[model samples]
Target: MAAAFLSRPVYPGLALVPQARRHIFALEGAGAGALTDLAPDAGALTRSDILYLPRDPDGAAQAVALAALGAASLWQAPDLAALLSRLAGLLDGARMGTRLYAAGSEGFIGQVLVVAEAAGIDPLSVATEHRGNRARRVQCVHCKTVAEEVTTQPCACPGCGLTLFVRDHYSRRLGAFQGVCIDAEEPGSAPAAEEAFR
Candidate 1:
């Protein structure tokens, strides 16, 4: 009976994440010094300049040691619209050698990546540490709607009223998984909704 609540025709193989190798500065959110395999001096990372998600101070702990170092900490619970406005000013005059480090919820890292990428910062120079719930950002191809923190597989599109089956494929351009109509073959036919995507 539990399966009755879950979506039918589950695309177990459809969820394909991007293949790009990311530079993992921290996965445990333990900060820079505690990063295994790599040990960068706080002074060096500071003098070279850095940006971090302020909510996960584990990485920021070392950056705080140097008072005169150029370090920018993003608020833990920041308003992306507002934070991006401020990040723009910083990126406008961003000099070479400045590194970006983010350690927080997946949403935060993903959103910050959008800004950093827009600023022309290479992904190689940035590090991301994902924390918190394992959710995803999904965008509907039909209506061009973005769904945030989605925790289900086959779900209804909040924008166009279409049932979408999320693919594992991730698009860097859209910053979300591609959600296509799973019942497109039969038009109105669809599987049961999953109580939770996780």
Candidate 2:
């Protein structure tokens, strides 16, 4: 269906941990009862970064729950834009041993992967869980400006003001889907627009 084509990009390299180490904590083992004594809003990881979007109640709950379950260190991001901004500073002095746990909508998860890749964090040290669907990241092909969680096609490119048609092709490197000007060949002409993307 059209929805399948409108899905977000998948970066295989960013998602997998090719080298699994025994010494490193297995994310699967971080069960609910692991570190219950700890507080939900404890703080940022002493040796890592626990990033989540505060706007997503589910993500916020998961972030706090993870902290309570021994993820003890945490940093709550007000939003994705703010987290992307602070991540640079967080990684500047971070050690190779530092880990990252991310949970949120696909758009948020994807962008987190972008930041993680940029930070040079090993895939082995990262874990992600999807909290929701129905959101997507749309990148402006003309300008590379990414519009987060765009819910409609033929929408105006946030960066260049072009009417973008969300294409099936997705670019993992960009963490967004391919978008082309619907009226590129013929100005003022376009396909019938849908109500919106869920």
Candidate 3:
């Protein structure tokens, strides 16, 4: 997954901010990371340097580090609203078309994209893992027809009298941006339909 590292300015003599305690708790619970402690060398930090540390061992560590540095804030959303807000602020003075890596789930990526679109920021990539459940199409035994794609649904054939069973299916819904693309091609080629348009 892609991890974004934000660099915030560290003011002289200011202590490490202790806000977001609840958020940190949630992060730790999620197996992500928490804002445990500041990087040891706080005095060594300059306006150009800040340090954030993650307490857990997941992709979220990088984000925590940035947050500790005061470069970015972590927004916890049932979806993506909070994340977008933090991303926009972090990218305030960044150049147009600057590539960013956001690591989360599919839903998380979607939320960030929604925010990016609203703020006129074009994200270069989104990173996630295959941890959640997904929909799959199975063949029905009764009807000999393919069962409709359903989430956590039993495979009951749509065709004649047959009952199909469910099996472990590998879903590509939570990978990189290409997770949704049906046709597999080289890393950089547009989908066939898009290529046809060109």
Candidate 4:
């Protein structure tokens, strides 16, 4: 099961990608396996600005912080904090009327909401659900050489051969929910169900 959400103010369309090196640089001395190899699709995330955050250790913190700095708008791949800090930062800087799209784990969404509230930024809305389909095996964020199955436990990257962990999983449902594009047949369609069932 997965969840997604669409934010208000409808941001200008711009591609946004995370930069692995920048995140690893930020986590210098924090650990050896700081960066993770992004998926090929993730790597091809062009036509948009990219900002990388570590996928191991406490990568969520940095991801959230970077997301909060989004000037065009904020969109996350369904991890914890949903990059709320980046969204907030964008809002704080100017009243550009940006939109936010977040997807990933439910816990991550909650964390983002909490942080947003604390920062005095109100999300347009939220939706919660489970990730759809099976999780894919991906390269270790730290080493960027080895491929491994997705797991909650920590493992080492095969390339650089550094220890790594599944910091956060991406979610499409969260993005749909934030974007208010979730389908009625979707698992987290209870809100829509109410229209008929109630």
Which one wins on TM-score?
Answer: 2
lDDT of 1 by residue, 73-134 (tens): 32321444655555655666766554555544455455666777888986445565544555
Please give the lDDT score at residue 143 for candidate 1: 99
Model 2 C-alpha lDDT per residue in residues 144-166, reported as the tens digit of each score: 88888787877778899889998
The best candidate in terms of lDDT: 2
User: Which pairs of residues collide in candidate 2?
Assistant: 43-74, 44-74, 151-197
lDDT of 3 by residue, 1-198 (tens): 113212111112212332211111112112232123324233322222211222234436555454564432344333234435556665565553344333322333334445555556543332222122233444433333544333432333446523233433322222112112222244334322211100
Tell me how many clashing residue pairs each candidate has.
7, 3, 9, 42
What are the lDDT figures for the candidates, one per model? Answer: 0.53, 0.55, 0.33, 0.32
Provide the global lDDT of candidate 3 against the true structure. 0.33
Q: Could you tell me the TM-score of candidate 1?
A: 0.63
In angstroms, the error of model 4 at 77 is 12
Candidate 1 wrongly placed segments (more than 4 Å)? 1-77, 195-197
Q: Which candidate do you rate higher for lDDT, 2 or 3?
A: 2
Ranking by lDDT: 2, 1, 3, 4
Best-to-worst order by TM-score is 2, 1, 3, 4
Q: Output the lDDT of residue 58, model 4.
A: 52
**Deviation in angstroms for 40 in model 1?**
7.6
User: What TM-score should be assigned to candidate 2?
Assistant: 0.63
lDDT by residue for model 4 (1-198), tens: 122322212322122233322111111111112122222233332212322324555556655654444322224334323345454554355332332233323333334444445556464332222222223233443334424233323433446544344333432323211111122245333231111100
